[model samples]
Target: MKVCELERSLFESFPKVDAESWDHVGLSVGDPDSTVGRVLVALDATADMVRRAHDGGANVLLAHHPVYIAAPDAFVPRSGSHPQAAAAVFEAARLGVS
Candidate 1:
């Protein structure tokens, strides 16, 4: 399945409207058209998780927690309050993992 297709399926089952108003619940990185070779579901999107996904040949990391609650002013890896999230987002994009 493609990233966008998986996203659609997920949202269909757990509608985005059901989430808290302030919750960030959607794809935070990667191209929607990218094909999903494998999926690694995890509790969070950390830099380590991104590496593991790449090592395990999973182009898609279906993490439960969103990378950020709100969009960052800039994506400066390891230089923010949420360093892990910043690193994960940067790494995911660099490694071409969705």
Candidate 2:
């Protein structure tokens, strides 16, 4: 299935409306139209998790917690500020893993 279809299924099971106003509950990265080969579920979108997902042939990485609570001004690896999020997002994008 496509990423959008999977996202729709997830939202149907856990409606976005049920989440808090400040919660980031939807897709944080990747193309909605991209085909999903596999899914890697985790608690956080850490760099290690992204690597595991990519290595395992998963096109999407479904994480309970988002990479960042708020969008960072820049996604720079080892930026000192929000390093984990930055690295995760950067690696995911680089490797074509959501």
lDDT per model, in order? 0.87, 0.86
Per-candidate clash tally: 0, 0
Root-mean-square deviation of candidate 1: 1.6
Best of the candidates, TM-score? 2
Model 1 segments more than 4 A misplaced: 79-82
Compared with the true structure, what per-residue lDDT tens digits does model 1 show for residues 8-66? 99999999999999988988899999888999999998888988999999999998888
Candidate 1 lDDT trough over 10 residues, lowest sum = 74-83
TM-score of 1: 0.90
TM-score of each: 0.90, 0.92
Which residue pairs show backbone clashes in model 1? none
Q: What is the lDDT of residue 93 in candidate 1?
A: 90
| Pairs in steric clash, model 2 | none
lDDT of 1 at 62: 90
lDDT of 2: 0.86
